[model samples]
Target: MAERILIVDDEPGILHALQRLLRHGLSAPDGSRYQVDECANGALALEQARRHVYALAISDYRMPEMNGVDFLTALRTLQPDCERIILSGYADLNALVRAVNEAGIARFIAKPWADFELLSAVRQVLQVRDLVIENRRLADLVRLQQGQISAQEAELRRLERLEPGITHVNWADDGSFILEDPGDVKL
Candidate 1:
């Protein structure tokens, strides 16, 4: 599946640059492919995210209506699976900490981030999201297998009563098995 990425920033230049950089090397979590979306502000970003599933979201921390942290925090409640990244020129350690703890941000990038560096960070966040989803799928599979095993175990217990000395039971049709005592038998 192609991973979906959403970029939210008020600045047109920064948004365009980042979008171009990401597109050049875009790939799925399995190294297959990627699909990306962009929004000029947090409101549109939130709207898009609600309608679709995004592997990751990158947003600027300063905007008129909503800031990155606030936007991400709202998104967290709606789509808990989506990974978040906060990019900002203002270096406020306290706000970053709150965003990380409250919104579950995957990474934080400064506004004047290197092109390659930004791409690398985005890649890492997407990779982590993929791993998390994969892990959940595997866990569900394990639980399903466990349920089957439990059912088989119950069947085995019922078979044991019918054939005490038999190690296995094969029934062509649903019928009860009768075992004769060893000493009392007609030759």
Candidate 2:
């Protein structure tokens, strides 16, 4: 399975560069490949987001029409489970804070970011997402198993009530008892 990733920036150069940088190297939490899509502005990014459910979205701050924070907030409405990251070129304090507080971005990456740092952040966020998904799966399995155990226990209690004095009982497929020991039986 390929995990989808969206990268958006107003600068065509930055968008292209990041797309190139991110294309081949990263792995998703499930050990799957990454499928990346790039856009030049926030509106296009939003459109893409609506069309597809992305595993992660990385957007640049200070875009012409909409900033990264607003884009991510809207993206959240479209797909709340999609993880987010903001790329801030100038260390805009207010926008960074808003991105974290309002948009619920997982990380803020500065401009001129090292390749290792960017990939590392991406890995960590995706790993967290995968862990959350796995946890939910395990919880569901536990619930199902518990329900089955409860049913079996109830059946056991009913059987006990049916033959309270019998020490052992085994039935054949045709509904006939193959073995029955009343516990007080003598040889």
Candidate 3:
């Protein structure tokens, strides 16, 4: 399935340009395409985020009501797994730090960015996101299997407590179970 991406910028031109670039230049590592969505401002972007899932969000640094840092910070609360990127013409050290530390932005691309650089950042971010998600899924599976094994072990222990040596098997040299006296079998 194609992953969804959100783009938030106050400038209509920048939004259009970013949409075109992403639509034409990027695809997931698995060769699936992206479904790009755009919003003119952070408020609209947040609204869209509440309604749909996004794999990535690219936001302009300076907007009217909310800067990219603020918008992305709020977005993190809504979608902690969604990767974030900041684009700005203005290079404010403090704002950049805030974006990184607070919003957890994956990349900050300067305005007038090279097409290759932007595309590469998006690709790398998506790849990392995929890896992180896969790792979480694997960890969950491992945890679930461990729990099942624990339950099975507990059941065996309970049975052993109920009947001593019940959990043990007498194996013959030929790899078959060596049954003792049939009268000795409990159940």
Task: State the lDDT of candidate 2 residue by residue for 51-110, as single tens digits.
Answer: 566888999988887888999998886676688999987887888889999999999999
How does model 1 fare in lDDT? 0.76
Ranked by TM-score from best down, the candidates are 3, 1, 2
Report the alpha-carbon TM-score of model 3 versus the true structure.
0.78
Off-target runs (Cα >4 Å) in candidate 1 are 30-32, 148-187
Best by TM-score: 3
* lDDT for position 90 in model 2: 87
User: What TM-score, to 2 decimals, does candidate 2 have?
Assistant: 0.73
User: Looking at candidate 1, what is the lDDT of residue 94?
Assistant: 91
Q: Note the Cα lDDT for every prediction shown.
A: 0.76, 0.79, 0.85
Enumerate residue pairs that collide in model 3: none
Per-residue alpha-carbon lDDT of model 1 for 7-32, expressed as tens digits? Answer: 89998998888788787777765667
Indicate whether candidate 1 or candidate 2 has the larger TM-score: 1
> Which of the numbered candidates is closest to the native, going by highest lDDT?
3
Model 2, residue 143: what's the lDDT?
58
Off by over 4 Å in 2: 29-32, 144-187
